[model samples]
Target: MTTPPFDPPSEADIATVSAQLGRPARNVLGIAARCVCGAPTVVATAPRLDDGTPFPTLYYLSHPAATAAMSDLEATQVMPVLQDLLATDETVRDAYRLAHETYLADREGIAVVPEIEGISAGGMPVRVKCLHALAAHSLAAGPGVNPIGDLALAQGDWSPLVCQCVDYNKDRASAGQ
Candidate 1:
């Protein structure tokens, strides 16, 4: 596996991610993607968390706006639609399979957990289980890498190109709970 394409997290990044998550961001390896406001939007976490559990979600969406957007998309019952696309569109299936492979490679580059090997977040390769994970992967890898993720993101009301973060400088309401 090659080196993961992400920057090491800074103290501010850790703090921002913690605030976005409303809890301590444990075992965060790096900042995968950032919002337009420069706040951490996606984080790269350890394959195995500190407690030795096999946590396979390597790219975690942290920004409240992005998280909310993904939640809204999920609430719309889009997973089944995308899953159908995967079942019929060979091109989409091929790309999604590649996304799963890329996700695994990125995780293995950092650390490999035997229990989670061959598993990628958001039900990649075969299903569209979590928009949050898929969106996080899309943001971290950039567009065209994760087609389903990109499609889900396109369906969202929020945009990373514009800062939709809610009061990053002050305590505020979190969308989509």
Candidate 2:
């Protein structure tokens, strides 16, 4: 809490993240995690945006491959299965609840937003809404923090150890963005 537990993002990082997300990176406080190829994977965003918006997704998945993998899992309806696991497994539920608490603590360590005080992203401690958010947290905070996130990353076909980034700049240049 004394110092943020992540690398401060540079201008090139912002540019690369923008390209990864196919839009401008908004209020990214730092790079939470990086791929093996040194590309941004998880981005740490501000608890609040410049426009007074309460943004709760602190650790955001920026890598296209990672996002696509999470999307694929959602498309395959894996949320229900994970939700059931959360409902049935007491240990996992307890860990998930703890993860939610830690997430709130981490965010509040920066600044407390009354509007999003108890709310954690990815339907944490209750539901399995977004695998991307959960996976991002796991990737950033490392293993054993978020149970659902660990499970999701285990089930997903993507690997952070390998870089799956495509040159979005080249794609945009060829298509004239």
| Best model per lDDT | 2
TM-score, per-candidate, Cα-based: 0.93, 0.93
In model 2, pairs of residues that clash are none
Evaluated against the true structure, the overall lDDT of model 1 is: 0.90
For candidate 2, the C-alpha RMSD (Å) to the true structure equals 2.0
Candidate 2 lands at a TM-score of 0.93
lDDT of 1 by residue, 78-145 (tens): 88999999999999999999999999999999887899989999998898999999999999999999
Off by over 4 Å in 1: 166-177
Compared with the true structure, what per-residue lDDT tens digits does model 2 show for residues 115-155? 99899899987999999999999998899999999999888
Task: Write down the worst ten-residue block by lDDT for model 2.
Answer: 164-173
Model 2 alpha-carbon miss at residue 138, Å: 0.4
lDDT of predicted model 2: 0.90
lDDT of each: 0.90, 0.90
